[model samples]
Target chain A: MTKKKLIYIILFLAPFAFIFLSLFVGRYPLSVPEVARILWGKLIFSAWGLQDISTTIVWDIRLPRAILGALVGGSLAVSGAAFQGLFRNPLVSSGILGVSSGAGFGAALAILLFNTTSYIYIFAFCFGGMAVLFSFLIGKIYNTTPTIMLVLGGVIVSSVFSALISFAKYVADPYNQLPAITFWLMGSLASARYQDIMVAGVPMLLGIAGLIAVRWRINILSMGDREAHTLGLNTALSKGIVVICATLATAGAVCVSGIIGWVGLVIPHIGRMLVGNDNKILIPTSLALGACFLILVDNLGRVISGSEIPLGILTALVGGPFFVYLLKKTKGGGW
Target chain B: MPLVEVSNAGFGYNGRAIFKNINLEVREGEVFCIVGPNGCGKTTFLDCLLGLLKLDQGDILLGGRNIKTIRPPDVAKVLAYVPQSHQKTFPYTVMEIVLMGRASYTGIFSSPSPADISIAEEALAIVGLQEYRNRPYTQLSGGEGQLVMIARALAQKTPVIIMDEPTAHLDFKHELTVLETMVQLVRNTGKSVIMATHFPNHAFYFENNDVPTSVALMDKLTFSVIGRPGEVLSEKNLKSLYRINARVVSYQLDHNTEVKQIIPISTLYSKESERVN
Candidate 1:
């Protein structure tokens, strides 16, 4: 491997390893060899009768949570990377397109208006994603420039949805539905199961794969629509495909994990800073780094205190200030 | 036969008609120069040829086929264009920007092939920018950037190259260098060259060199003077075309003893009546 490739691999893998080990090590310290043996036994042999509680902890609880963390992280990061390229602005994220607000409104509507269970969260996410997609399509039909008008349309859509969410909160049975809405917005991996992973994993993986396949084209498209079209690329079609893929990926993640903040916005920027702006490298590296960053943050949330903090809080706590610092540094120098 | 033919082409933006009843033909292996004042629809005409703008009336035919029938990729294979200037916002290497010319040929998912690299290198060599290939394009001088744009057009390997004010940003020496390279491309490769420029002197220079060139001077909508060097570059023709009296003066170079021409517009008008007296 090239030195740069090796460095990125190490940087990407080390955090994953640390998070994996930390998951089993805190309050119930299992040796690396022991954890390895437990994982191997569970995989290669049907050894349900293993002696150590380490097997149960790693297999049943932490493993599903870790996988879920990776899925959510990878989805957010890849989506963020694609959006940044689409807008030609590194600051653009999933939230800019009203995906989060739409998802939040969907979830809130399900909980408050319909009094639905967590099972309806996925529906909410899909509805939210579709809302944003519809807005974008309408804007395009009217010949709106994707940069300014599309973003403004998203903001408008998000505000209307936000008011709906507030209205739903007001009408909701405060004791029953309000807490569920709040908890979903805070986001967590505490309730993750293997089934939850299965629900979210398919779309996330598929979206990331599609983005990777078209990453080079995305880079070319970043030059602006006129240049891209002159180069014989169907700029409109390519952009539509990318936006849909990113939306599906993010929607799947938000459905399962609620509105986890910062990973989508910050991970791609971090990936760019680490490996440079070539999307060929940035896409995959963002996926790996995002998975690692979130897994590490989620694990920290698990063990940092007597009680588990929300994954959303942990990421915001870490990514928020770091983002500010990056902003300050890049103030004089344009990113 | 003409390689590109625009018959009675009319275009407008947002219901504002800019030009109407425009007719032009660009033949192969010849340099066609389009000269007009600012905003005479020169760039708009080029845009129409490239299918960047849709024409409200008439047809544009390439190789006797309507442009609408040809796919964008096929059109790209036949015609390459270099804009007046490109905004290099990102930090792409000169080679990387040049390599983007192969986008039409490469597969959607595949990297550029070795043949693409070779073509790009050859283009860079043609523009005298071989050594600067690895340098960041944004860091290059204005002249070098202009050359890089030409190199990109050359890399397309198209039969016809269209440039809108290719030398607009270059100094005098670089302007000459770019024009010389363009003329060489037409002469050696048998590629047709179409360029738009404000400088009438360039058209005179090309014509005086016995190069295969045609000059078209746009005066107003549907009014133009088109002919060979001396036929269309007379003082009366230029005065009518530019709405200013101008003297076309010829001078012999010291070293080469070649005839050079200059169009002095501002001062020549005052001297016209004096010379008449």
Candidate 2:
């Protein structure tokens, strides 16, 4: 095999390795062999001779958290890559259209009104989708100009939702609901469960599959609308599909993991540096690298202190410095 | 019939007329040049021909069919565009950029096959950029970038190519290289070229080719004359169109051959200098 193919193979395997390794690093640590035996027994014999605590740690806590981390990481990075290509700007992220802020507002509102976790997830997902849709509609009002206007609309919607989130914070019960809302916005996968994984995994996977299928066409889209139109692409339809897929993935991720930042913005740039700018390869590369990166960050967050650090803090702390390093190294032209 | 025929085509935006009574024909295997000052609607006319913009008054026909009837992909199949050199936001390799020209041939969900790769390679060879295939497009010089775009159009395998200011940002050597490449495409591959340029001399340069060549001198959003470059690009027309004092001179070579050249002397209006005097 070629060297590049070998590199891709190694990159693809890294995520699985991280997932397996992270399954043993949680607050209730399980040995590697014990975890592996439990996984193998669960998959095959449906029963493991391992202790109840071991099974609980592996099956209930670590597995869901790791899997959810991988799913959210992969989806966010892929969606971020898609948006960057769609906008023809490397600085863009999956949250460019106010999805994160909107989801934050929705979660805050749920905390203030319903005080229910499931309601928070549902409201967050719906509001995230609505935020993107609002931006798209505002952009449509000036159909003659698309990309710039859409960006502007996103800015407008994001600020509005941010204000709403602040308002919700003010009205929230300071001692009871306020901290909960604040913690959720700070972002963590600490409470990830199998149900949360199943609930959010489906849409994230669908969005990922859709992006992978249309990834090659995104190269043409990055050429700008006029060039894409001249190349015979239905610019509006292609762009709309990309935006929808990205929104669905981002919404699903935000609903489960809260507003985990930096994975979407920085992982794709790393992927582009490893594999060139061909979206066909870049999308998958971003998926694998993103999964591995977020899992590593999550593991670090749990193990670094007595209290588990929020994922948003660790990701930005790690990813932000790495991004600066990449800028210095590649001079911001990794593509 | 001409390969592209724009008959009485007019285009306006926001109820303001930009151009009207525009008529032109690009025959097969011809180098058709449109020369006018900036903002004379030359690019708009090309857009109308590409079916990107609908004409306000009349219609454009390609292969005797209404242009609006032909879908964008089908139009792309017939005509390729080489736009001016601009900074690329992403640093795609030359091969990747060239392969994107085959997008019209491939399905939206499908990747380029081996055959498409070969075609792209062949196009790179045509533009003499095969050696630079692995290089990042952003690292290429202005001239090389323009050549890569030409290679992309060549990869499209269209009979007609539309280039908007292909040599605008190039140095003198690059401009000559682009002009020579245009001549070669017309002479060897029998591809028709429709280029919008501000340089009347460029139109005249291609006029030296043996294949058919035509020039359209545009002014006030309409073609003042459209004919053989030698016939249409006269001193009087150049002066009128650009509001400059210039001469279309013929220079004799050592081998008893002659070449047409446009030399501008001065601008018609020097109000600032006049006021100073």
Candidate 3:
């Protein structure tokens, strides 16, 4: 095989290795052979002879967390890449369409009004979708420049939702619900369960698959609207589809993960560095690298302290320094 | 018959008329250059021809069919466009950019096939950029980048290619390089070219040189003159349209070769300053 193909193979396999290795790492700290044996047994013999505590730790806790980490990270990164290309700006992230703030507001409002986890997830998903809808509607109002208008509309919607989140924080019970709301906004996968995965997994999978199918088109869209039209692309419908898919994936990720940041923004650049910016390869590369990065950060959060550090804080802590290093290395002309 | 026809095409936004009463025909295997001062709507007219903008008054026809009736993909199959230089957000390779020209022919869910890849390689070869095929488009010089775009148009394999300021931001060397490539494409491949340019001399590049070319001098939102480069780019028309004191002169440097050169002897304001003195 060619060197690039070999590199891609290694990149793809490295994540699975990390995921497997991570299953053995945690507060419980199961041995590798035991973890493997249990996984094999569960897959083959249906967890009948596996030890109870090991099974619970392996199957119930770490597996779901790892799976959710992979899904959320992959979704965020792919969507970030998609949005960056759609807007033709490398600085854009999946959150640019107001999904994160809208979801944050939804969670905060849920905490103040209902004080339940399911309500938070449901409200977060609904309002996250609503935010992008509003952004699209606002973009359509002008009808002349869709990309610029969508970006402006996103900024407007994001600000309004950010204000609403602040208002919700202001009215929240300081001692009881306030901390919960704050923690959710800070973002964590600590509560990741199989149910959460099943719930958010469908949309995430759909969005990711949609992006992959149309990933090549993202390259065309990045050429700007006039070029895309001249190339015979239906600019409006294609952009709308990309927006919907990316927003769905972003909303799904935020609803489950709370507000994890940086994975979407940083991972795609890393992917671009590894493989050039053919979205066909870049999208998948982003998925793999994002999964690995978030899992590594999450693993650090689990082991580096007495308590579990939030995924959002740890990602920023790591992503911020790494991005600076990347900037320095590339001299700001890498793209 | 003309490969593309723009008949009485007028375009404007809302109620403002950008350009009107535009009648033009681009025949097969010819280089048609549009020359006008800035803001004379050269690009607007090109956009109308590309079907990117609907004409306000009349119609554009490609292959004798109304362009408005042709599907966008069919229009793309017939015509390829090269826009002005702009910063690309992603650093796609030269080959990748060229391969994107086949997107109209490829299924949306599919990528460029081996056939497409070969076509792209052939295009890069045509532009003499085979060595730069793997290079990042963003890392290329302005001239190289413009050539990559031309290679992209060539890969589209269309009969007609439209360019908006193909040599706008290039250095003099690159400008001539692109012009030679344009001339070569027409001479060798029998392709039609419609280019909007700031330089009237570009129209003269293919003039008196055994090449088919036409010049369209635009002024006040309409064509002032359209014919052979030598016929349309007369001293009187150049003086009136550009308000410059210039001459279109031919220089014979060799026994069998001649070149047309636009020499500016003086500016219109020079005589005014002399009178003031």
Candidate 4:
């Protein structure tokens, strides 16, 4: 049919194909029939005609990893698109509100204090949400969340939390907790168990749903607060809703996946190039692209070397240069 | 009743009074022009009427209802605003930009429907920019961008449109196009326009079109004069407000037509010999 419909179909289908491919693409390569048998057996009933190791490889490890990758990638990218539109700045991402740094510190601190497994997720999520709240409250110092002030608030909170994270590292046990914190900060989906997925899924889905619901309003909001107000938009309510949704999505993602960077920042730009800047299409497009991009990147992490490459390192190492290329190709335009 | 009525309305910020004790009215099929120096509260006055800001001393009413009582969405259905400048950050297509005008009617979560799309297309047709519908808005010139913005306001389907410095930063042709579009829209749709502008000639332009034009000059932070463009826009008023001696000249264009324009002669900062005679 139309070009846009074609793009949507491609975007919507790419993730499923990539995820299925990922099921058989690890240290233990399973054949197509084996992977299918494992999936069918595990999903339908008992693991009939499937080996235990094969089923665990397909259902337990790769499935959760791919699904978690999809959720976090979609959430972060969508949050970036929403924040970019709301702030009317192309360079801004959800992390501009200090969510990533805050979550990093929280995870680090949780590791420093408690040996409990779930404490990392809890601390990361709360601190991520709290960091954004602190940024938002700082933005409201002048009784308004003016764009500049909000960005400044994010910068302040980010630096402060960054310093705190550094301090936590210094006092941390170098032999035990230091490596844990460092590995977490470098970011990986090696630990994408069902527990992490279950913990992050609700808020991630909630934020994505909210952003989609308010997607059209982001167009009006990109006109700036005064213009939006004149257009009869309840900007205060709309802006608050956007901030909360973005915060939720961001914090939820950072909690499970640690600090996966650049996907949120770069994926929206790719979506914009494909769909133009209409948030209506750009948002969903970013979602699909982000899901696909992260799955692909995670695949590289699994297969590129003998050991798994950290997602945070891979994303920045690759995406940073690619972002610069996009910036140049766009010639400082299309923002 | 007037579409918008501002009586005894005053607004200020940070312990400074911007404007006070203002009374104004806008009727259907009328062009109400507010001209003043920069930051003379022309935009502030417009914001008050649009219910974006509350009147510090009094109230503004829309079609006999107090403006404060009407919610923003309802007020949007009544009046649309065209700001002085639009950011080019997003490369929104002209059609997408125009479709955003339907946002007032669309639910917060919903997309624009087919009916809204047709309405937006109709707005584009009215502005004669239908061919530019799919072009990136950021790629358009300042004048074309302003037309697209005007088309957006038209798409809102409001009874009145509020514009702040709509003709600013436009070439000669685009300025005339904007003024002509305003006159044509008022004539065709019976929609009133409340425009704040720096150019006194815009009032004369409307008057020349036989549109009922009322020019209000905000001098000394108040309405110094309000009446027909030719009668009220004098050299004395221009000097008092802009601190410049300006000539309000009438040029004979044809056998039966005269064009009125304002030409700045000298500023107070000019050398004595070069000062206005």
Candidate 5:
């Protein structure tokens, strides 16, 4: 590997090391050896008799939350990379097609009207399906593949969902559900559980794998629709499949842990800048870097304030200015 | 049998007719050049042949069958196209880009086979871009990029190769190089090549080659003359198509010299009467 590749691998691997250390070395400190023993013992026999309190804190609380954070972060980044390639625009993210807002609306509706069991997962899938359907419909109606139409469709659908969410908020009792809705919108992995992991992890993992497998096709599509078709690709069908797959992954992540922004938009750009624009390299690199980025951010959220900060706030705080700097540097040339 | 046939074909977009009542046939092992003014439906016609655009009126027969009835993959198996210019957003290498031409042959999940790789390499060598195989396609110069596009078409290994303005942005040397490559491709492989260009001099040069020949010169709006080079590329025809009073310049062959005559229509004159009182 080149020096740059080596450095990126080190940079990406660093955060996992820090997170592993931080998991045990907190306010209730456990030695690194004890942490290792706990992990190994749990893997083999399911009970490490060192301390019940440490087990609960490490396995029950922090571990699932951290894993959820990594899953969501990686899904968003991979989705963004696929979207950027599909639309041939560097600035696009998973949210460019109204996916997040649509999922938020579906979750809000489920919370308000259905109030049924496991409504979060249901709402997420429904919203994602609807967003993809609308995006395709709008693209078809326009008869053009210009990115502007997709963005406009996203904005319009997002506005509709935002209005619905606002209405739901107004009618919501200010005591319980209102707080839940607000917190969910703000985005957190604080309430993450083992069940959440199973629901979100499977689809996110599948999505990331699918994107990697189709990475070369995505690069061909980035050349434009005509070139792709002439290259013996069924451009429309392939694009639709990719969009649906990406939305499924994003929705799965958002179902468990609300709308965590910026990781999707920022990490892929960083991946491209560091590794160059080949999707074969960029996809895997984005996954690793995204996982690390979110873990570090989540750890910072935990450490800096003595109480956990919402992941959305932390991501925006870090991603916003960095995005501006990248914009300035690229000067919109690659788009 | 003719390799490609357009039987009274008509095509239009959004109800605006671009071309109507057009008919042409390209035989095997011929360099058929279509030349016309801007917006004269040259690219649109090529699109129809490639099945990218549906014809409004008639049928295009490829290999003596209606193109619409043939599966797209099957059409791709026999015909390949090189676009005028391609925009590069991702950094794919020249090898990767050329390998994409083999997509019709390769399975969906399988990588390009050894055969595919060798074909791509052969294409690169033919286009004189073998040394640039590993270079990022976006970093190539315009002429080099055009050559790579040709390489990609060649990699398809199809019997019929269609090109749209393959030398549009090329300099003088590259222009001659592309035309020369096309001539050699037809001569060596007996592949039918159809290309649309603004320059008719290229057609004149190709027709002068010592091979069984078929050539056509098409002008804007409705004029076509198809025959041997000396008959079709007369000064009257050249002046009419280009709308310039051109003097035909010929160079006699010295001993052991094989270069043919070249006509340079350098200046164009306005329409005026040459009246006798």
Candidate 6:
């Protein structure tokens, strides 16, 4: 029990440590005392006369990016863990409900029509939410929303939105809109700002908090509907809560982070290995571990090349091989 | 008063009647066993009694209240259910699985408390799986899984437990072990067990008990006969129910002990066809 508590302590603190580390290692790298002086909240220059550029770089640029990374990463990971439990499939991730495709299509359409960046977040969030609504309405074609029906609904909605995205891409301006849509679809956290936190990050925080608050029930939800019912669960209500929370998290995340994947798919599996399948603990652990992972990876992305490598590329690059190794080591018994 | 009562109970799908006009009641501290052939609505009947399926033409009462009137959590406090088997995708611990039975007692957004944990531990002790609490549920043998399920049911602390073919996949020794566990549960805890099984001998095992016992035979889609095991389990009834030519042989093992057995000689096979379908 003490060992488990120690693990919880470390996981809880890992993200903060990484975020702190990130504040010092940006393009305009600030030294430890210099960064600490800026963080100490006094604009006054020290005896060494640290430049205003250092303060602006650390406070305005790096802090928001790292915090946004933590929020997006935590949102995706928690929602992914919750969806896996609700759908009763280990391979299920945050985008299984068509949110990413919907958001991707919305971003492409906005790029094609308006040729501006301001409406992109709103369109992406709206369409992402609508896609999940379509999936939910399709699931309601039957008397009750069975997990199988929900999954099929998700598949149908996802394919429709993905085809729409392709259509938008085919007609976009070859020079300007095409590249813009392509980059948004590839996903990067480089555009993260405090305003992004005010807009999309609020929903992300709500989702993470909701999932963590109601996480213990995922254990009962994973036992299948009938068994959970027999065990006295209001399965419909429980499933509704999980679906709503996960959708909010995914849509809000896609709003700011573009179309990042793999973090949602792999972080929860890693969390399961660390904490077992008990969502009660795994949800919070996923939140913390996901924050740490994305910040570190985003820092790597920033420094890996002269031009920024998109986070979607980096996460998949790292996550795919690591998942293969996990599969081979555990022989598909990692959960 | 009976703990569970059903009157004129009927259920069906797509407006097709499966069974109707059934009447039965289970008392406290009694062992109630239902025996039937394949696809004879035994599981359907149990599902209706457990309130999973809505009864089309009748009502079931738990603790003298209509089952429909009681919420699912309230019904859970009065009755528990054990499935024939479960296929687990995630590797939840046995203790975690058993603690799931406390769901009714806990709040929706909360987990099991220390009190709930102790209750689960006691239930594991009842099923003789105390030392296996930390084991993964997916790795256990079939019989052990069934026992773990029973522990989960026991943790609910319900007065009545409903099981559907709790021993269908077990070997001879494991079957007897589960059967003994069920009987002992009734004898010691005074909790009524309502189970449906394919074996008539399973009902016979509940014979010679000091507590009240009921053996019910459901057949011919609508016909059901409930009585004492010795009174209802006759050779003629077995033949009519299962089309089996069987003998009920009683061996006097001692002055006060008589071992009753049902040995099937042949399947009548519709009594007219020489070809097997």
**What DockQ does each prediction reach against the true complex?**
0.39, 0.70, 0.71, 0.75, 0.36, 0.71
Q: Tens digits of per-residue lDDT for model 6 on B1-277? A: 8899998888888988788888888998898988989999998988888878899998898878999999889888888999977878899999999999999999977889999999999999999999999988988988999999999999999999999999988999889889888988998999999999998888777785444778889886664688988888998898889888788888887888777778877788655323422
Give the whole-model CA lDDT for all candidates, comma-separated.
0.79, 0.88, 0.88, 0.89, 0.77, 0.88
Q: Chain A alone, TM-score for each of the models? A: 0.90, 0.96, 0.96, 0.95, 0.89, 0.95
Q: Against the true structure, whose DockQ is highest?
A: 4
lDDT of 1 by residue, A152-200 (tens): 7777887877887788788878898988888888888788888887877
Fnat values, one per model, are 0.23, 0.65, 0.62, 0.73, 0.27, 0.66
In the range A140-190, model 4's lDDT, one tens digit per residue, is 999877878888999999999999999999999999999999999888888
Shift in Å, residue A43, candidate 5? 1.3
Scored against the true structure, residue A176 in model 2 reaches a CA lDDT of: 95
**Which 10-residue window of candidate 5 chain B scores lowest in summed lDDT?**
B268-277
- Write the residue-wise lDDT of candidate 5 on B18-115 in tens digits: 77777888887887777666777788888888888899998899889998898766788778899987877766689988987887786554457799
Model 3: how far residue A215 lies from native, Å: 0.8
Clashing pairs in 4: A335-B89
Please provide, for model 6 over A27-141, each residue's C-alpha lDDT reduced to its tens digit, 9 standing for 90 to 100: 7767899888788754554454445888778878899999999998999999999999999998899999899999999989888888666689989999999999999999989
- DockQ score of the complex predicted as candidate 1: 0.39
Over A138-226, each residue of candidate 5 has an lDDT whose tens digit, in order, gives: 86676855555766777777787789889988998788778777777777777778988887788888887778777767776786777
Query: B254 in model 4: Cα distance from truth in Å?
Result: 4.2
Error of 4 at B217 (Å): 1.0
Per-structure clash totals for the candidates: 0, 0, 0, 1, 0, 0
- Indicate whether candidate 2 or candidate 4 has the larger DockQ: 4
Cα miss at B209, model 5 (Å)? 4.5
